[model samples]
Target: MADTITLEVARYRPDRETEPTVEAFEVPLRRDWAVLDGLNHVKDNLDGSLSYRWSCRMGICGSCGMTVNGEPRLTCATFLVDYAPGPVRVEPLANFPVIRDLVVDIGDFMRKLPEVSPWIVRGEGTSVEEGEYLQTPEQLADYSQFSMCINCMLCYSACPVYGLDPEFVGPAAIALAQRYNLDSRDEGADVRMDLLIHPEGIWGCTFVGECTRACPKGVDPAGAIQRYKLTAALQSLKSFVLPRGPR
Candidate 1:
């Protein structure tokens, strides 16, 4: 086995350059090491100036997301052997402003998450008691899948819509909205729908599905977004048949 691995990493020094560029590093590595571990090795031994973000290397924290060889993935979950035989390319996630090497500004992504109001909205007294709000197994199953999102923002990085126009709500936020909409207790879906399924909402998704592919948690954000669209369309059609408001 080779004693060292050569990595072609994208480097950006905001104070020094207007654009990012590629630089190579040769460092010793083990076959059992994850990419995140290798990055630590680079930062520790080969270059102290390398920049990246990471936490909870076990993959639950949703940090350490970056584009490895042009594919967005959690560095904590990606292994070096997966791209063996020599040099690997590491870069920051796409579609966001690069703050530095392997680090992108995610403020817009976070703001979008808040725009969807990603939470349950029950009355104050509902959960004030010690017992939990009643939920059946089926009800839990309905939204439980979508609620697993770790907020890695890899989906946004993989989305072409966001790359083309950052105004688009992107995938994760819409999926989170649907997660609450599917909830048996939440009443905030309507309040959030106008922000979703609008021109800049789910419709903006060309369905390239790269966002779904990039998700590390199997959240299936594309499917969730599509479900939101269908539900919104059906509700719009039903409004015609419903009785008029109380006179």
Candidate 2:
């Protein structure tokens, strides 16, 4: 129960420094304040030059994700008081190029997201006039858990596979693809199969399960990837056994 705590924040200025460096700043350690709040204090009161991304202070925006003490977490959800009477390390997310202090480039994730077509694709003749697609409770349950992903990129930070192989589609995107794939109203599953089955797709996952562990929203990307693997394997077997013509 100390009055203040030291935050060792990472600083990187492309114009000046070739690598990142840590800078310490002491901020009030209120029980109600979160790690994000401490960063805000540093930016507002101490140094305006510090840079990071944040919005909606609530965890829903998922923009405040950072490496807090070597763990990927939503800064808004991580209470500052939990670190107790000492210094806490804050840095940009791992496995991504640091744009600045505690801010990493997310261009890679944005580019890969569309490859899976995370949406509901229906038949060409299907029209809105046909009425909205209705779903039962059971149907909704199939993909409900995956739908919680807020695209925080914490999964990417925690994924060692992505660190080793940046070409991998990563976890959140794959999980989102599965979310729509499981939707009863969606017909894009077949279209996305090629991407998911690619070497950089679901196959890239080694089932380390760090992505699921880092998710604040309870979206289990590892589970989704594993499930997709089984489905893909079965489809491959069926294609091998069945004739090329329509069955």
Candidate 3:
């Protein structure tokens, strides 16, 4: 195994340069050390001007996401030894405005996430004293897979539709909407559907499937979008056939 590996990290200082540039640094290539560790080493030992965002080195914070060799990954989980014997490229996530080195502005995602209302919504006249909304294990399993999203934004980095159309609601938000929609206790599916059924919502997804492949948590946003499309289609059919009266 190589004793050291070179990291070609992207650098962007808006005050000084109009475009981002690459800067290389060499760090120890340890099997236990991740890409985040290498970047930390560069910041601590090599240069102090370098900057990035990271918290909970265990990958829970999802703040350490970056483009590693043209692939979006959580640097905290990407082992440096995996790219041994040569240089590894590290850059800020794609399709987002760069804030600095290895950090991109996620304001767009933050704004869109709340539009879907990822939280559970109770029906009108429901009281908290009505006892906890209990659920069976089977019921919990329905949305549990989609609930694993940590808002990493890696799926956004991989999605082409979002790159082309900034107005698209993107992948994570849609999956999160599904997370709530599938929950048995939630009564806000119709409310969320108003936003999700639009052209910028479920229909925005081209089913390129990159979002699913890029998800670190196995949350299949593509499947969720497809499922929502079918649901929307059926709902449209029902509204046309069943008339305005209650069924």
Candidate 4:
């Protein structure tokens, strides 16, 4: 590998223009450097004007998600060696309003999160002091995969449905809602049903499956949404038959 490389980063100054532009920075990159490290090099040594969001250098924080060479990925886990020979393009996650260089506004995702009501709801004695709610391993497995979302919004960046309808409750948020719904300890499944059946809810997803593919943490948003769809369909059918059934 070369001693250094030129990383082409996409820059968008929302205050200045409606469109995004590209800027390049020559960094002293080693083969072992992660993309976030290269970004820091650009910010610290090469160009102070270059901007991006990052937190924990490890992949857990999920704060440094971006598009590397047109693929949405967590920068902390993506390495420079993967894209050798210089001149790798780095950009903010796509399909969202840009706040500034390499930082897309996450308001849409936040809105969807609220729409899903992502929280555990129980009966009147909701306090933990009441008792420990228990579940079998089989119950945990039902929604275990969906609970791994880090809210990085990379799935939104990969989803075409969000690009088409900004009002749609996105994949990550919906998947999270399903997580709680399937949890044996939580009893708030009926409360979040409206979100699942809304026109701009699960119906918005086109099964593109890009959201799941782009997630670095193996959070399967596509699978979660599909499972929620089936559950909602069965619930709707049951509602027609049982008068006091889950609404």
Give TM per candidate: 0.94, 0.97, 0.97, 0.93
Q: What is the lDDT of candidate 1?
A: 0.88
- Report the candidate with higher lDDT, 1 versus 3: 3
Q: Name every residue pair that clashes in candidate 1.
A: none
* Segments in model 1 whose C-alpha atoms lie over 4 Å from true places: 240-247
Q: lDDT of each structure?
A: 0.88, 0.94, 0.92, 0.85
Model 1 clashes, total count: 0
Which regions of candidate 4 fall more than 4 Å away from where they truly are?
Answer: 15-18, 126-130, 242-246
> Which 10 successive residues of model 2 have the least lDDT summed?
238-247
lDDT tens digits, residue span 1-247, model 1: 7877888899999899899999988766787788898899889988899999998999899879999999998999998887876688999999999999988899998888989989886655454557877899999999998999999999998999899999999999998998898999898877888788589998888788988989988899999988888888887667656746321
> Least accurate stretch of 10 residues (summed lDDT) in model 1?
238-247
Cα lDDT of model 3 by residue, 15-132, tens digit: 8999999999999999899999999999999998999999999978989999999999999999998888769999999999998877799999999999999999987646788878
Clashing pairs in 3: none
What is the number of backbone collisions in each predicted candidate, taken in the order shown?
0, 0, 0, 0
Q: What TM-score does structure 1 among the candidates reach?
A: 0.94
Cα lDDT, model 2, residue 183: 97
| C-alpha RMSD (angstroms) for model 2 | 1.1
Predicted structure with the largest lDDT when compared to the true one: 2
Count residue pairs with overlapping backbones in model 4: 0
Positional deviation of 178 in candidate 2, in angstroms? 0.4
